[model samples]
Target: MEQKVFIKYFSGTMSRGTRGIVFLLAIALLAICAQNTQARVTLENGVKSKVYLSPKIALHQGSVANKYYYDMEFPKGHIAIKSFNAEVVDEEGNPVSLKETYLHHWVAARYYQRKGIKEPKHYGNLGFQQSDHIPAGNAGVCNSASGLSQFFGLGSETRKTSTHVPDPYGIEVGNPLEIPSGYEEKWLLNVHAIDTRGVVDAMGCTECRCSLYNVTVDEYGQPFKPNYAGGLYCCYDETQCKVKNGLESVKRNVYMKYTVTWVDWSESIIPVKIYIFDVTDSWQYTGIHDCLIEFDVEQSTTNECMDTRRSKSSFPIAGDVVYGVAHLHSGGIGSALYGEDGRVICSSRAIYGEGNEAGDESGYIVGMTTCYPKPGSIKIANGEVLTLESNYSSQKSHIGVMGLFYILVAESSTTLGSPVQIHQESKVPIFFWGVAAFGLAIFAAIVVAYRRRRQNGDGYHSIAT
Candidate 1:
């Protein structure tokens, strides 16, 4: 009835040309509204983002807080994670400088707990080896026994590093089909931070030097080998590093502020398997994938002062590498991964900061370059041997240094061609084109109506003259 009323008024009072222009304008308006609705739906279907803070950590001058919290708050339900970024923050939500509190590392791992079982209060350094808890670690390369099985992790470089999983690909988690019966999925967060304020040797503390920490035993109360000097074993929870004399100890609280971006799981989202390669892996000779988490680089006697380490491991399965990044300590120069045929798969270099701010603390590694190769451009054949090389400066002795390469691989069976792929490849959104078309239609209608009116006025003026 409203349409009839609008047509009756326009048909009686408007010229045919004006009526046609009005109809075009109305159609354009409807098109814009439809586009707006579709854009909202697209965002709803695409990705969701949220920021969360972990439980508060208490620390005094030169103290270390390396605690693991089970069942941390994470996005619940089945989803494909696109990215995870984190940083240290004080109580007022302000960014904390790395110069003050050194973020040794933060690791996020997945696990499954029995439906009716309650987890224990203490989860000692042994990890989730209990019967009721099942650790769901990364895809492979490092054995679970090595404790480098986290799905996501970073140290001081966490602030500037890019962990985004590109379009059509994501780190899949929490799928109902993958969960065992009577067990539910949960996330575990391990934050290892060192309070370096007023410390005698800031660099030594961050490097976990045993002399500065004054410890001759590991976290498990086991005696350290004679050659073991500095590493994670020396700076376990509650351990203290050397602090300046007469500096009153002041306690403060801090938290790990992290942001997570993910999308609801769907058939179109291709799953990527995470593989972390360590330069210290001794799988070739030992016939066991024993990965020494950290190693020291002694100062060279010769002039070169460059320590180079390499390891070779076979790819478990054939797949396309979607993303790659390297994890290196402060003294690391750079690292790279080479295929069996000597092709460079990825090379990541540590980015050192030169400022005194939080993310740009001078002399600290703020970030590492990342790799997002074109889909299918970098492929790993089944059982292909790959070489990893990590370089560090040996001008000064460095302890607890690590060289880890993290990569995301998608199986060959997952096709890259999809409707989502086209959308992702486009630099601009479809709704923007719709908006431009709508604006053009309005402008065209106004010009057409103005010319018609001008023509009618000219005809009347000629008659009057």
Candidate 2:
């Protein structure tokens, strides 16, 4: 009986030792798994980000620079773009205030240029008509010739806007299969800036009032209609706004400092198509989308002081909306996109600056709100009639105002799948998790065995006593 008790006690001690070792081994395995999970996630989500400066722009008091920079330095090779943000900066990389230099608008366009051909002297004129140049614009409902074909564009509100494409969805570009033979992909940047320092009317200059610039003809020397008061035509390159008499200001060089974020294209990444809607779209009347990019807001005639414009058009394709945002100029109150059943899909309001800093320049639009709907919640059916409504405070007449909506759509939600599926596809390698779970199972089994051995040892001691 004493020998039996000794054997039982020995077994209990061995079991306890085994349990402690198993517990430590389990903890160590979990730590290694956590490290492995992090490393795996870093590898799978290989998002690369970089900031680049555009070709230098020279400006002075009341001067304007509306230049198209072709073959601008950009990320090379096939990739999925995640976000693009830009701000005007001086030569020293300091952010420039909108009060000093108003950013009218900046457009980023994609194109294909045939190899062994000289680049066009001006992309705005040749556009897609030149034999050597092919405009690779967004999935559009607007006429490409109307200058609304850009994949990305923003006005003074660029600084505060959110352009990030969420996880698993991206803007796919630079695919070799899509590029035409003997042609290479290229990008174009159009920056229209107006220096308002010492100007007679800063807001008028920014609005491109023809009187402020003292111009009757456009950049191409084309005559403007007698009633055409102001717009982009009045604020072309080399044009100058009326300045204060004898007010001296030195010329300064500035650049559009742009940052791009993207990830290398992979099978797991779902591509999204970009579509831009214009409130001035006349599709129902013209049978073709004629997007008048700008319009004039006449002052109120009575007590009502709001100018509201609405346009309805059928969505050309069926897809799920991933993200949306509006591009509205100064004086814009808000804008909204509606579905066929009058459901509000998305709405964005302007955020005006109240200070004198670069992003917070007083009385200037610093940023606009954005929309990110659930993966499959907001779906646009093919041929679905959509309405766009834009409102502006009509306290006084304003020209060159814009109301545009941009949205990114995915073909289907299957690619994104359920949240659990997205996690499984993007990160959390099955093999590693399986190993961790196996380790836990073994640890649990050892615990149970230790408890049984202890109970048996206790019974044997009781009998011996």
Candidate 3:
């Protein structure tokens, strides 16, 4: 409980507006720490995972792991946070082990800081900070198991074994998953819960279960056509411009699933939370017939994007359809074309094949969600939302990137119908239509009066002559 409070409070200060998902992360970390210090969580698999002290702080779980799952850009060839489990499981369900001594360590995969059109063409490096063994075994694997142990940096034996990985768990796609400043896509997230590394390594129930969440960003960094007039779009090349350009930060949910389990513990449980965000205008097209003109949202509603990088949605539109692309971190895998009523019509997953690794595509936006329009309804009515979900998180998925997108669900009212052209001529307002109608009527009456007067005058002139 105290840990949760600490994170929430700290997050309030550290996070900038709701924009700081780091606040949520801080909350999660606090919960994690609390679970380690003062609580017990029991699971269905008979493995009881918990924090060991006062007031039992944190959600119960033999399931649900959110903090573990991450959705970030993964550089090509990098081995990242696949999965991690922390729990103590003897043959019997026991939250507390009378004779087990524990040691914990924190491990992370670090990437090289380099700039490129997409994610780097290579994987980065990883290292584990170690810890000294626990001096006392009086309490449950609460604070000690989850927090103290890891912060000290204990190393693992499984991490050393590269030759014999019995089960391959992770979305292993080729190339790198990219997410620059403006890249945007619907995002999903998850976290893994690990309590006892020893038992997880021993039991071989290595596949971990996790929690999920969601997030929505304003836009993908793929710049729109340069506005030579304002010089705002030119910042893509300058790199030094101070103008803010990362899309609107909008996190809405978080999801959970499983990753890796080289631990030896019995089946365990975990509790986690999730967060997700959306980029409201993500559905627009960028480059096809022309770059400036956006393909109608109506087309996007019906035809899902095929071949995200090399392909597009040809909605049988009037003009040639153009293309616009976006990206998100790893946790954004399950993104798809959902209807206004929340019915998913087409999806990026189906086009790319469900659960395809984000790192597989060479040209697709990095960390991008692979979604498409559903078959039945491609067009969206007002008040509809696209839920991008999937891919549990890990340390590897945390590098900041872009997020969820929208395709002009509705534009600003003041700037509404003003465009290059309209459905027929111009989008004159309702009042404009009324005024034009009145003017036409007055002009017609004047013309009628002139014709009658002229006819009378002609008759009189003829009689006088």
Best of the candidates, TM-score: 1
Give the per-residue lDDT of model 2 (tens digit) for 188-209: 9999999999999999999999
Kindly give the number of clashing pairs for every candidate.
0, 0, 125
- lDDT, model 2, position 242: 96
- Candidate 1 regions off by >4 Å? 1-45, 419-465
Model 3 misses residue 288 by how many Å?
31
Task: List candidate 2 segments past 4 Å from native.
Answer: 1-45, 121-125, 418-465
Task: Give, for candidate 3, the lowest lDDT window spanning 10 residues.
Answer: 266-275
Q: On a 0 to 1 TM-score scale, where does candidate 2 land against the true structure?
A: 0.80
The 0-to-1 C-alpha lDDT of every candidate, in the order given, reads: 0.87, 0.86, 0.25
Looking at candidate 2, the ten consecutive residues that score lowest on lDDT are 417-426
Question: Which residue segments of model 3 deviate by more than 4 Å?
Answer: 1-326, 330-332, 350-376, 385-392, 395-397, 406-465
Between candidates 1 and 2, the one scoring higher on lDDT is: 1
List all candidate RMSDs to the true structure.
11.6, 13.9, 33.2
In model 2, pairs of residues that clash are none
lDDT of 1 at 346: 94
